[model samples]
Target: MERRFEPPVDGRGAQSVSVPTRFGLATREADGDWRDYMEMLEGPPVKLRTSVVEEHPKTILTFNTSPDIGFDRSINAYRGCEHGCIYCFARPSHAYHDLSPGLDFETRLFAKPNAAQLLRATLAKAKYTPRPIAMGTNTDPYQPIESRYRITRSVLEVCLEARHPVTITTKSDRVLADLDLLTELAEHSLVAVAVSVTTFDPKLSGKLEPRAAAPAKRLAALGKLVEAGVPAHCSVAPVIPAITDEFMEEIVERAAALGVGSCGWIPLRLPHEVAPLFREWLSVHFPERGDKVMSIVRSIRGGRDNDPDFFTRMKPSGVWADLFRARFRLACKRAGLEKPNFELDCSQFRRPNVGGQLRLL
Candidate 1:
């Protein structure tokens, strides 16, 4: 195996690991090139700057038939997540573009600037059926770049105009920017937002999801959403065993205190290239217990770095799994929280106008 390349990109989850693309393709590696030399000429190491390449596609909706997934369709406005979560299952997706799922996945990104228009076109079809369109399903729609691109807000506007039902899953407080749209949708029970809180420790969260909103900010976003009458769900996602599991109770308690309607947890999932990258991350950040962390992970993963089977993939087994379930159940009970309800009303959906068409009031 070729050794993974380490890059000096500040504010990244995997500080020194970039697992090469598994797909057989020509990939660029840092070869003490100009960027590396810039470190010597400059005071500190050269940082990897974020770049975006636009893609124009006929359709913006993606359909999946997996039994466990809740929704049938989703929209991914961005290809790679800038959050650079070390354990993101979606990291492998960048390999298809001949990019490393490590640093490349965070710095080199693809944006669908025309996604809102494409989504409008799809919803305007005469035979179009209304179902909850999911955003942030693959790559988060409200990552840092969203403030400038505003693609997510544009999509929300289209949904609001069509009276379409939509669900947003994000890890950024930037979702608060569209509170006006979400507030209106909630009035009709057509929208739900799930904010994923990984950990409450700021330092740990910074290391885990580098560019995502801070834990406090995410919790505050949840509070604001619930206060605005928008259906809010606090997703204690990818609870890292031995690292973040300790905060499960605190997170649930805080969510309940904030008047959050629902809450849930998803165990850590290391899929494909993410496993190696995460192992490297563990070695760097938690050298003392890296072995122990992987041991617990493997125990729950059926003696592997990951579990990829359907049904069982999302539902991890083993004693560790049982312990986690019981702990989360107790946490929710103590916090007066319930399993999140993502179902929203789709009956109010009206076909959006296409091209230059206008609707009569």
Candidate 2:
């Protein structure tokens, strides 16, 4: 007769700190291993992290009713980001899926493999109005996996086919890979690209943005984009006080040197889940300066970790914000990096009708 074995259980079954347990029948001991008789006793349940399959959104265009942004609509090719910036403002988005906004946010990523097909279908709609569609708003379109998925490239192809205007914002030098397509779009007045440079210092960049392209590579990409005749601009985002804020002048100067036509800077914002994550990161990377860094951040955030109000979120209030503005203005003045002059023309918009005028023709 066969015997059944029960799994060893810890203290509490439901509320126990450890995982679930099961039991198995003990068998005859053979070799020196005494546990072999237990067959396959249930010890601890192996946590299987499941990746949910999300339907490919048929319509690629998304409306942004929020007044905080300059554009009304945008598109993201991927869901979770692999960049793994501890201070990333988009981290909280993972909570919607019951996933940890920490390591899981970086590791378990999702890409919209059908983004190009959706873009084409959306653009082909007769009622679809053409506006400069923004890319890389929530997560970077050129993030690491973009190389394999090539979703961004496909989206660009759709925009090019429709002669639709596009404005891209990214921190990856991988944007250079789309140079030929971008140059073609530029000739038709259909494209603009902004490369975000948080800090020119490599060490600071290493901690703030773990998997992002090197700062030097971003600068080099800026130069390359400009040389390719694509309207290129520099954005120094989330400028932290007493830290990267000090490099404002140098960043502007270097941008101008790279032939970047325009430059902009935004004060640091540690909103939602980002504040604590950033604190943890700072504690690990710059333990000595962690407290000081949070103190300065609080000073700008009105003694809080974050300010969610639209006006205050992008550019914080108080002395720190004022100082940042003054320094940025002075630096831009000195570097001759005037405000971005690239204004996408909406007047030329035309939805190529099915049997009417073929745009490319």
Point to the candidate with the largest TM-score. Answer: 1
The collision pairs in model 2 are 5-23, 5-24, 5-25, 6-23, 6-24, 7-22, 7-23, 27-37
Best by lDDT: 1
Q: What TM-score, over all chains together, does every model reach?
A: 0.93, 0.82
Clashes of 1: 0
Model 1 agreement with the true structure over 42-139: per-residue lDDT tens digits: 34544565789888988999998999999999999999988888888898888887788877787788889999899989998998899889898889
Q: Tens digits of per-residue lDDT for model 2 on 98-142?
A: 555554456567778888777776777888888899998888899
Q: How well does candidate 1 score on lDDT at residue 201?
A: 83
Q: Candidate 1 — which pairs collide?
A: none
lDDT, candidate 2, at 163: 82
Q: What is the lDDT of candidate 2?
A: 0.72
CA error at residue 124 for candidate 1, angstroms: 1.3
